[model samples]
Target: MHDSKNALSVQKLIADLAGIVRIMDQKDQQLAPAINAPSQSWLETWMTAFWETLCREWASIDQWRMNKVLLLVRFFIREQFGLALEWAVKQDPKLKDQVARQLRVLEAWPLSPRERRVPDGLRLHVLDVWTEELAGQLSAAQKALDEDAENSDPESKKSILLSLAQEFMEPVRKISREAISKGVKIRAKEAVKLAEEQLSG
Candidate 1:
């Protein structure tokens, strides 16, 4: 999407190009097989069409809309893929690990219009790995924390848990600070220092 001066439907044009991008990226595995070897499988074609739509929509949306788009993408992946998700995640633990990395990028929350070039292509790369898969990992982490809590003294637990929470929370605090306009960055200075101290300690 662009300013008023831009001609034609930028949304449609972007979507069209993004459809091609999605197909091209998946050509080797998902798209090529259907084209080269003519599968009568309704399932395969349906899946491809779904992916095409997702990619096209993702490319053409603003940041706020993009959040909704990603949620829909996750929901569709889970719904379209049921028991298969377990097999997929089981087969590729590394892919599950990558989702956290992708989520971190999303959480940083790019400022739309300005940071328009954010590559959600990476998100698509690992989309087959579902939220349950990622959430399960987080649950596992928290479970470990719970187990640790039983063993740790109150002071030790406070230190460890506070340390962990600080680790997770500091990035967002940093971003919220950074999100302030250029003139307001000075205000972020103390928050930035706090994050550094928390991180370093």
Candidate 2:
């Protein structure tokens, strides 16, 4: 049985690696063959026990095993970064330009600090990639709002804001407090204010 103390750490490591793999598969056309890959139910069942054994004895694990784990983590970090950059390259240039200015701020947003077995450098890299992805999404949204604002008359813009506030209440509220680009945060705050105004008026 895996030691209770280390179980969470092991699970976190697996989750972190799995998340990277998931994103890689999402962004890489080379992995399209996976759609027809054989089912891995048997492998999944076996690996569960294998990981339990590995984590339970990690403290006294041989040097070779430690090196293997370290190398795997490093390899994934490299691949994840390459794939993330490629994905970003295929995105809209206008939105990418907007997100670029705020990418550093987004990457510095605080995440839950936890004690995990994954190397701190790799963990931070993973977080940066995730934050960049979020910035792209937020920038796209802000640009869309800007386009709508330009196209709509004042009264029509109010209607659009009302609809946006109603549809995106939770996300707008969350983004308003996040370390997103000032423009996006301002847009979110405006939506929130509009929502409140309509509620009171």
- Model 2, span 1-201: residue lDDT tens: 434454335446656765755543444334334665422322223323433444455577555456556444444434333333333434545323322322322232212123243234333333333333333433444455466645444344334333432432444456566623555455556656655644310
Worst lDDT 10-window in candidate 2 = 104-113
The C-alpha lDDT values of all candidates are 0.40, 0.40
Per-residue lDDT tens digits for candidate 1, residues 3-117, read: 5454345456445544543443344245434585533333334455655555456657675455445554554443332222222323344333323333344343321112333
At residue 21, what lDDT does model 2 achieve? 57
Q: What RMSD value applies to candidate 1?
A: 13.9
Q: Count the backbone clashes (under 3 Å) in each candidate.
A: 0, 0
Indicate the TM-score of model 1: 0.28
> What local lDDT score does residue 115 receive in model 2, on the 0 to 100 scale?
24
TM-score of each: 0.28, 0.26
* Candidate that scores best on TM-score: 1
List candidate 2 stretches off by more than 4 Å: 1-60, 92-112, 115-201
